[model samples]
Target: MPTDISRLVHNVNEQGFTALEKTGLRGQQDQGLVSTLISRDLSGSDDLCVSWGRILPGQHHLCHHHPDASEFYVVISGAPLVHLGDTDYRAKPGDGIYIPRGTTHGITNDGDEDVNLVVGVSKPADWQFVADE
Candidate 1:
């Protein structure tokens, strides 16, 4: 059964970090900021997962890589710095980024507003291989 993403489970919780609980993290400090898992393999599609994340100013996602799946991120609001492989890009509303499988990437919200991004993965994530580097 295909789950309607619009009707999927959703929740927002305080992340314990003052900056994260308040607005979000800024710069490289965002590694532990707000993370919301919006959807998973509810449809039994072993090859897909969708998630929405918000990063507060000065916060960042640490360098990491996926071994079997390519990832895509669509900027829904605000601007953020994105690091993929050896390149750095600025992402804002309406922008999209595609990360190839096995590539190192991360995101940083250094602006004033909260950075919202919608992420989709080509394969159901393998938790054991997900490392925070």
Candidate 2:
């Protein structure tokens, strides 16, 4: 997708008001496999971005980092293995995980079903996708 912030301002009044079924899946198909249920670009936000991420069973989100933005995630369903820096945190429903800017982190769904998460990030312009190692 384009990195231009100008194209990310489709708000509620501009046809952005809808649910997950109305939106399409996002993320790299080969590696960062996941679906974005919602996003700031779809909600008319430039500074911050939020979305619901869904990872299928036995799939991994691939370790990566946002060089200029802080990221966070709230587990909505199933167990998501969150890898942060030098440790791994198993996050269940209601668990909130925070990853500082420039920190290495990722998520994995090793359960038998899908893992859903509410993900948020600051400085949407600085979002970057990187490898775990």
Candidate 3:
């Protein structure tokens, strides 16, 4: 059986995935940063907003926070300084950092190599608060 992928696959290259710069997500065109959106719009997944993010040496994503969503940054390459509020982590390849909703976070690459990360954020909950019966 063949499953049609006309809408499911947005970009396919010889490597089988779209290059980060071609996706046009934030940080892609910004100097020293590259990002590719991989969730929600790409997969129709309701639970995540994920992307591939890269930071070149001496570059950083300025500290910021979102009130309604938590986030995770999993290191794919290069050890970089990851900021989670008042704490800082020198995360290496394969390391994962979780940032709670409303907590400030960002990442900086100080080394000579680029820092690659698989970044994910939680989606808005479909459930609503209910008063006790």
Candidate 3 versus truth, CA RMSD in Å, comes to: 8.6
Q: Can you write out model 3's per-residue Cα lDDT over 1-133, one digit (the tens) per residue?
A: 9987753554323213333222123433322443435456556768876666778798766666767788888899999998778888899999988888788776778899988778777872322211110
Q: Per-residue lDDT for 19-102 in model 2, tens only?
A: 222111344432223334335545456677776677778667667777878999998899878899989988889998889988
Each prediction's whole-model lDDT (CA): 0.67, 0.67, 0.65
Residue 51, candidate 3: Cα error in Å is: 0.8
TM for candidate 1 is 0.69
Model 2: ten consecutive residues of lowest lDDT: 16-25
lDDT of 1 by residue, 25-119 (tens): 23223343434343354334455676667777777777678787888999999889998888889887999899888888888888999888777
Task: Please list all clashing residue pairs in model 3, or write none if there are none.
Answer: none
TM-score of every model versus the real structure: 0.69, 0.70, 0.70
Candidate 1: global Cα-lDDT? 0.67
How far is each candidate from the true structure, as Cα RMSD in Å? 6.2, 8.4, 8.6
Q: Whole-model lDDT, candidate 3?
A: 0.65
